[model samples]
Target: MVLNVAVVGAGVVGLSTAVALQQRVKNVKVTLIADRFDEGTTSWGAGGLFRPDLDSYPAEHQSSFRQWISDSWKFYNALASSEHSQDCGLTFVAGTLLQNSPKDLGYSCISELTHDFQKLDEAQIKKMNLPSTFKYAYSCTTVITHVPTYLRWLMQKFRGNGGKVECRKVSRLSQLSDDFDLVINCCGLSAVELCQDKSMYPVMGHLVRVKAPWFKKFVFSDDLYIIPHNDYVLLGGIKDAGNWSRAPDPAKRNIILSRAYAMFPALKHAPILDEWVGLRPGREKVRLEVELIKGGNKKTIPVIHNYGHGGHGISLSWGCALHATRLVQELTSGLQARL
Candidate 1:
């Protein structure tokens, strides 16, 4: 018998999981359901940089978090090197990360996995046009994804592989249990309501995309960053936890532009292409475990949660999707054995 799987959420995590599922599982039908897609999702507005915070997860899961970062890096690196890099919106860019102190400079988790990770000297910083206030900095090669374009590419790839997408909101998990053999929840912040998870909240982020093709590399300091894509550059942002509003605040946009312009004087007069506000699903820890949902009439469905990735959704997507795929395989195998 063919297994039918329902993946909730069409964002990066959900779509990635669906793609991975179809690629790895045999004789399976996968459907992606979400209320929004492409530009309507938070992933669309992301800078799409591949920098994972080493401290994002708890101490016990640190090893696994590092593995995810490594896997994600490798995945994006391979994509960047492929002939379809431009079409897939993947590009390798070198950048400098500045900090007030050297103690806070390095990401120890996957530092070894990054390309050309090195501390920068004062001379190097001056040459890079960084402010003199920056006492320590590091340079590394990282991948950046043009999110809007990339999401479209992912959707096309998924559809081409026989996966289906449904544009609808899921009010409850029980509603899907009757039809699907398994349900994968990658609903991001919506998991708070869908799973009734109090641990999940929103982290409001604001970014401005401007026409600045000359800005060749990424520059990050504190919570602010300047990420350059093919046609435009992304200037961001603030991380206001517990803020759920998606409305773009004009004052906040001005502040971001002001700070970014201070760092790179050339951005002072760059034409603004678009402004965006997104709510990143923040949690104490990302939930990526399996649960069994028992329904009426002696029926049950396996749910593998893959949400609460917060700002690192794009960074950790493929890695977490691969992990989710493994969980699906194990759950299916166990079910088959029981039958």
Candidate 2:
């Protein structure tokens, strides 16, 4: 018999889970439900670079860092090579990580695969037009994705394969009946209230998108980054932990723009297209687990939790999706049969 799966959340993580589940099995019905979709999601504002700082991952999780990163890179890199690359906002970019502090960014292992992994010299530093003094830097050929484009592309791919999307809010897990074999929660920030997960909180952030076609490289300094995509450059941002305000602060907007223009003087000539504010679904570590939600009449529904990607939603979307899909398969197939 075919399985019915409901994936809650239309963000990158949820959409990726829906696509992966459908791809993993045949004749399965996948319904993706979320209150917000496409351009409204926090994923839409992400520069979508593939760097995962060691601090981003939880220390206690059983997931292998190498496996997740390798799998995600393979998936996006394949798309980057295909003709649909641009349509999906997957492309190769030369990135520079300007070190402003003593943070241990874990890109060393993958440096060889990057565009260029070299310490900056005095001459290169002078030409970079950056204000922060750095002792070391890593320049790499990395991947950046435009989340809005990618989300639309993924939805089309899922629908083309018989999946469905509903623009509705899921206030409770029980709202989805037992008709579905499993319900995967990819609701990001909403997961905190839906699941009563007090551990989950929001990391407030903001960004400015401007016309900077002349810029082609991605720059990173601490949590702040200025990445250039096809037609626009993304200037970001602050990461305020446990903050939930969705409104952009005027002071932050000015600070971000000033810093970005300082690094790339040409941006001063470009006009700002838009400013956006979002809450990165943050937790001590990303939450990806399985639970049995007991409803009225002692009915138990299987729920696979896959939220809390923090600021790295796009960077880790595919990896977590693959992991969640595996868990769903286990719950539906073998010893873990019904909740």
Candidate 3:
């Protein structure tokens, strides 16, 4: 008998996990169950930059962070170069990150993986034509994810591989235990309710997508960023924790537009294509381990908890998914669950 596996989210992390399960696992029926999908998920509105927020992992797992990011880069980098890139919304973007004061640019894993990475000099910074407050900068070439396209591509890939999708909200883990032999919880912010994970928090992000075909390169300073896609440019945002509102705030829009206009005057005349507010699921540390929990039938069921990815969900997705796949492999070793 094949093991039934369920992944409980549709964001990048969830879809990535489901896809990895199909590609790497055996004798399993994978079903991606989520309340929302594609453009409705938070990952869709992300700037889609590949910078990994390394601190999101625990101290013990910190060493593995590099490998995770490296593996993820390899995954996206391949797609960005493939013929399906435009169809999948995968783009190789090079951009500058600036700050007013000198700070530790210690994400060596990202720097090491970038196709081109460097610190900008006075001339380089001058060429950017930024306000004088920005004194330090660096440039790097990395993959940016257009999650809407990527997620749809993943869904199609999953279905092609004989996977299924259930568009229903799982209020709790036990509810799924009856149908699935093992459940991989990639619930993201919903974990706060489903798993009673009090540590889960939401980092509200506000973004404005403008019609800027000329804005090919991205520029980021703190939470404020301008990232480009195939058709439009994304200007954002605020990173206010514990803010759960999804409606776009006019005040937040002004803050984003005003700063963007000052940084790139050309966009001042660019028509606003859209605005969005999405929550980045945040936790003190990412949780990626297995637990034997009480099931709906009172017998134990295997649960691989893989959520709490914060802003780096896309950056660390494949790495975390592969690792989660390994956990599923171990859980079903020799079909022990069948016995």
Best model number under TM-score: 1
For model 3, residues 210-313, the per-residue Cα lDDT tens digits are 99899899887885898898899999969989999999999999999999988778899999998999899898777889888887688678889998888888
| 1 or 2, greater by lDDT | 1
Across residues 1-339, which tens digit of lDDT does each residue of candidate 2 receive? 677889999989999999999888655789998999887787877778877666456555524655666678889988998998999989888878877554444654356345466766678877776666776677778888977889999999899989988898887898686456669999998877898999888888888988878888888887568888888888996888877888889899999988877766778998999888889898877788898887654666789999888877887789889998888777766423443
lDDT of 1 by residue, 223-330 (tens): 689899988899996999998899999989999998897787878778999899999999877799999888664578889999999888998899899999999888
Give the 10-residue window scoring lowest on summed lDDT in candidate 3: 101-110
- Assess the local accuracy of residue 326 in candidate 2 as a C-alpha lDDT between 0 and 100: 89
TM-score between model 3 and native: 0.95
Top-lDDT candidate index: 1
TM-scores of all candidate predictions against the true structure: 0.96, 0.92, 0.95
Q: Model 2, 205: alpha-carbon shift in Å?
A: 1.0
Worst 10 residues of 2 by lDDT: 101-110
lDDT of each: 0.86, 0.80, 0.84
**Backbone collision count in every prediction?**
0, 1, 0
In model 2, residue pairs whose N, Cα or C atoms come closer than 3 Å (at least 3 residues apart or on different chains), thus clashing, are 115-141
| Stronger candidate by TM-score (2 vs 3) | 3
Please give the TM-score that candidate 1 achieves against the real structure: 0.96
Off by over 4 Å in 2: 102-105, 109-115, 121-129, 335-339
Q: Per-residue error at 314 for model 3, in Å?
A: 1.4
